[model samples]
Target: MKFADLSSATDYLASLTRHGVHPELDSISKVLSELGSPQDKFPAIQITGTNGKGSTCVILDLIYRRAGLRAGLFTSPHLLDVRERIRIDGTLVETDVFLEAMQSVCLAQEKTGVSLTFFETLTAVSFLVFSLSRIDLAVLEVGMGGRWDATSLCVPEVSVLTSLAKDHTEILGDTLELILQEKAAIGRSGKPFVGTIPPEVLPEWERQRSLRGFRPLLRGQDFDGKWEGETEAGERAFSFSGQALSGTYRSSLTAEYQLHNLLTALATVSVAPWPVSQETVRGALLHLFHSGRWEPVPGFSAFLDGAHNPEAAEHLVRQIQAVRQENGKVAFLSGFLREKDWRSMAHIFTEAGDHFFLTVPPGTNGVEPLTIASYLREQRPGIDCRTGSFKEICQSAFNWVAGEPDRLLVVTGSLYLVAGVQKWLSGDDSPLHAGERTSASPPS
Candidate 1:
């Protein structure tokens, strides 16, 4: 297919990922080889886990770039734009550069007659951009289970796993042990691997590390971080102490649970080949901000978080309750995708928030908004719940929050919902307002 603009190219790629899973690296490896294996042109750090991987990537990128290294960061399911998935030296690659890299991958696929998944093509494009820009190092977040994930095509200097939980069970496995087995495959021989793995999954990770001849740096045993306190502005004061480095850092990021992700990133940096000063790490933490992970939208009184799964939802509830003032009304704007633990998520949010606004996420995978409304009612009878288009929900949420000074609004459940709500508020032409009809039953 011929493409004249980034939108068309991205739309075509998105179509490929619908009901997606072509879990093999042969096609991506071949396409990269055709393009001179751009992924091998630079050193990379691979990160994989069920959660906290994106936040860990963001922290590592901040530290590397702040230390004056030319850093390339590639993550998935961007919160605002696809360009956000690929960045060079702390800036999104220019539109022209993104399109040029994508075009090269398209040509390679046509020549090789190897169809690539949406994620595979984007991964190739990121490598191409990194090669063209001559980045010193790249930080890659694994798109899914790591064994055959497209982003695992590169040979990483360090492999980091943030935290494991129940997600993508159909593709990964039904149990945490099975899921950890897939994620543990990212570690290679002689490569430094680090992460916070649950006690139950430690044996599998150890087995992989032993077979691969790589030493695994455990989170609590090898390194740890503590949330020291919070400022009046809600900024967190945290400290990281490891065998190599120890320091107290301040961050504008307020989520208390992120201290675990921060420590994992710090541990990876400490063991990485690159040299970064404690001062640089401190500075980077102060300015670090990642969108849609307890991110507060500017010019609005709401916070956005992608707390899709039960584990993440538990964290979201704690964070909200911690910051909420006594007698303050907690208002929520939530939308979730299908196949998620919507019943658990509903109970969590309804317990934490006094009022709820439900909206459908931006695609066919969206769980029907009213389906969640029903779940919320079952959990909390007579709960203040309303549903409509994204804009309508936001308008209602804004009006409700405005009624009280101590009210706080949290937008959570799915990243797609946060992105859609952000676009609607930004006055962009967003797909969220379409609000297509659906009567799908909520997950059991």
Candidate 2:
């Protein structure tokens, strides 16, 4: 069926994913060319990495908006509405605008006679929407491995890679070297690049830097950040010295990993050609709140974190352990996609607690809850693992840790699972509530 409105349009786009990933960028490039190359109309800042890409992009978007610029942000795998993927001036683009852009993108695809994958269509839609809105700058986050991802077609003013890890090993290659090579390829020739790469990947990234002939803004060499201590409000306070906005920065984010992501964002914005004042940068961080990353549910004791991969899972376990009481019980309500390294991640959680309830991520690609529970059992023999409906699992987890000040309830594994719980917590139990756009603020 042809897409007739916003709902149908999103469904139609979702349908394209069944055809599998088409990594080549020729089709997206053709669609953009047919649409008059809207991507070229504005300056873009490209962000790519195995982890922390979405959080970093969101922080950069807020910072850019506070600088008095109409920033356009394009990120992937929206927690709620599909419109969340594309935002103008720190707000989601209206449904009418999103529909109009999708319509134009479909028309451009027809004219070019080139098939676009789900992400490719969204990439085109973002470019079209940004062009129509006359945005001052566009922040594009690479959907996956960046060599031929749809967002790689843009010519970025600065490329920021925030910490590479072994998340997409099946597609991007299993080795860290191979993965870094693919991600580092997002760097444009003769443009500034910044990254928080590991020492093992530094040689590969440096090689790419030499080949691309761009000035390198590295983490250890060009900039350094340290977590000083906690603020009076119980928030994390960090200190960094770099060419960008540097000082003792304070954040309310509960995860320690966010400190590195924030520094990477600061480095990117500092090197950009735009004029962003220290006051603006500070103000942006003060108001920053991206959902599904250590986000607390409105009226629940549980915290939601979308740390599906092993690298992020390690960080999450540490954060939980840091605040958890010595004898407090920590029950986990979690789900995961099929392709993720759930085994490695599941083992990491075993160290934090043995109480877990696994559920499916609400989609075709979701691994069965029973399957994940079985894996957890194998990882930690005699662990308390349960599987059932989303509601039952959530209620059970809450009950397990209820009213105990030190006892913790965590909804983790996948962002989709977190979104599912967020919907249920809002008094709307339907998983499809994410796609049902109404007159409301962006999720969380």
Candidate 3:
């Protein structure tokens, strides 16, 4: 099979684990062992958290690339292409190359009777591609909690946690302590577990580190970054202590909370024990780009942060505090699966000043537009918001933008929603055709 024949890697992996007896690490580890442990050759930075994992991975890729090294980045649930899951130096992999890698992974698994989950197969395929491509460093984001995620197979040079929060309660445990335990699973015997978590999580984190025998780089304790000021270019100025970088300029992604994620990225970059420089951090931060996180299209602004759960909704609201505009109606194009906290998610972002554009991506997890509109009215009465096909919503938003020219528009609430809008806006077919209602399924 060739790269062009590699369109449905997820489908192929899904077939293997369709009736998953379990999602365990040991089975995945043993299978990788049979395949020659391609992950062992992939030296990388590992990041896990309820949010900000994708942003951190992007920053790591940018920084390492700036350091004159070939960087491979593997993230989840790509917006446009499966190639987005496998990138070198911030660019998507070529079609033929990616297909070859997937073919190789399929061939490797034939000999290892133990089946790998969708995420596990994707992770393994990424490692195989990165290793064979001669990547100098790979940045791998945990697909879920660190402990059992397929990416956990390697011992990363820097293990980073970015603001622990509640998510994936069914697969992980129901509480924060249990959630942190699952997330902290990536920490190896001696690798430094660097984090930019809030001070409130310190006590529980320290206790866990002691038990795991992992070295800790707690933010504000081991290393920290200071917000210098806002630059004339409208970008932010900040400096790091652990990495010893000064006057670093950052063009942020998603939320201003991303500033904290950026700080952790720098901390990991600084303490990486490899020959990386402050200049590299600056260069990387300057060019660092990740789509679907508050990305803006021409004529209309489209913010694409996935606010599936309550905590993410709160964070998105907090990040929006920095958004300044004199006047223009605020409207949101948002929707989610029936299982999520839809009422709370919408309330946090639907303030006194904003209008709403209800949308459901064409996916299994997608909440119907009218259903969302019904919920929105139940949450807050008499607020006029459009509910319809995603393309119709974008045209509505774009038309609104043409009139106001300065109004703020946000398209969020679900990854499926983002993928659909991204595909439509870019003039390509929306990937919603691939949507599987995972959020509505019974607990694993």
Candidate 4:
């Protein structure tokens, strides 16, 4: 139950995959039962979406923490390491802590011989750790589909659907509406659920949520954004109503498409079971920051995002359009895994951004660099892309962009790619900027 046990714990956790194909609620329920029903301990703010769930979860955490509540957070596919998946009051649970939790889960599974998939087991550990920490609330992000997700065990007081789009077609469905249905499964009877799906899909989402027995808050219908003034920096501001609260503040993430997520977070907290004040809402927004949402990091001044899908890539472009002031070279550092919607996403980024520093980070879902570069070159005839060591490629891009301060270095493709950069630049690989909390976590 110490740090030295991590390797064995990891093997034990990995062995849970032998449970075979993922099933519905019962498979997950059995795993949680092994942990003594930790999922029932905390009131949760459940979030599910193709993208932006992570951002909204961060915003919810900030608001809850601002209101002086101990909040627990759980997200997927950590950028740097596994410990990022569990957090109490914004600080990540330590390595030793995770190893201990894993030991408990593995021992329970072994004794019971209860089969558990990777996500199910991890979700169980996160819930147990959070329950033991005595968090006032937990902001749980769904791994894939909404209804059957391991985190869906708890019936949340409020569920947030943050801006749906077409991404996972295989397991979910081929169309946006089908994917929306799968994601919208997070809703429960009488629970307040907010739809962050774009305006086009709002009608079906509305009908779906109503049939599911939840109060639905649909964007572009219930609330209206009025043309508002600009910040001194000339940022666009919109005043939107959230049944109970509204704000016309500038988003620091610099992604134009993030408005949907920001509003979704606003609506979620407005109808939350835990009471919050207007001052708490205002205070939270002023200092809000998610790890990688077109974030402008220091020194290299890189723009980081975890967009690996076609729709997400399109959203990132819209975000870039909002932030980019003038003409500048964008040095791209990217990677992708085998199952990614690469053909769809390829056109989204390859057509807009310059070229890429394609790489395959060790122990990651990142697509091989040669494969990515070749595909990118074929898709976009004029683009220049190359394969190289991830570290050198990231460094070269950063230095190349740093020389032209006006230019930008866009690092994306996968959270695994971002984690490789974070591990080297901010990890123990370098002493320059150590202990920095790089937001490398992303939804698969």
TM-score of each: 0.94, 0.94, 0.89, 0.88
Candidate 3's C-alpha runs over 4 A off are: 1-4, 8-21, 198-200, 226-234, 246-248, 252-255, 429-444
Name model 4 segments beyond 4 Å from true.
Answer: 1-3, 11-21, 198-207, 224-238, 427-444
Q: Write the per-residue lDDT of candidate 4 for residues 118-231, one digit (tens) a residue.
A: 888788889989988999999998988786788889879998887677766777888777888888888888988887567667777877867798888767766545535433
Once all C-alphas are superposed, what RMSD does model 4 give against the true structure? 3.8
RMSD of each: 6.0, 3.0, 5.9, 3.8
Sorting all predicted structures by lDDT, with the top scorer first, yields: 1, 2, 4, 3
**Higher-scoring candidate on TM-score, 2 or 4:** 2
Better of 3 and 4 by TM-score: 3
Question: What is the TM-score (0 to 1) of candidate 3?
Answer: 0.89
Worst 10 residues of 2 by lDDT: 430-439
Local accuracy by lDDT, each model: 0.82, 0.81, 0.70, 0.73
Question: On residues 1-444, what C-alpha lDDT tens digit does candidate 1 reach at each position?
Answer: 567887887788788776478767888899999999998899999999888888889889988988999999998778666788898987778888898888889899999999888888889999999999999999999999899998888999999988899899999999988898899999989888998888987788778877777778888899988988765464678888887768888775668778888889889999999999989888777766776777665545568888888888999899988888898889889888788887788888876896889888876478778888888887788998899987788889878776466889998988888888777776874222100111211000
Number of backbone-clashing residue pairs for each candidate, in the order shown: 0, 0, 2, 2
**Residue 75 Cα positional deviation in candidate 1, in Å, after optimal superposition:** 0.6
TM value for model 1: 0.94
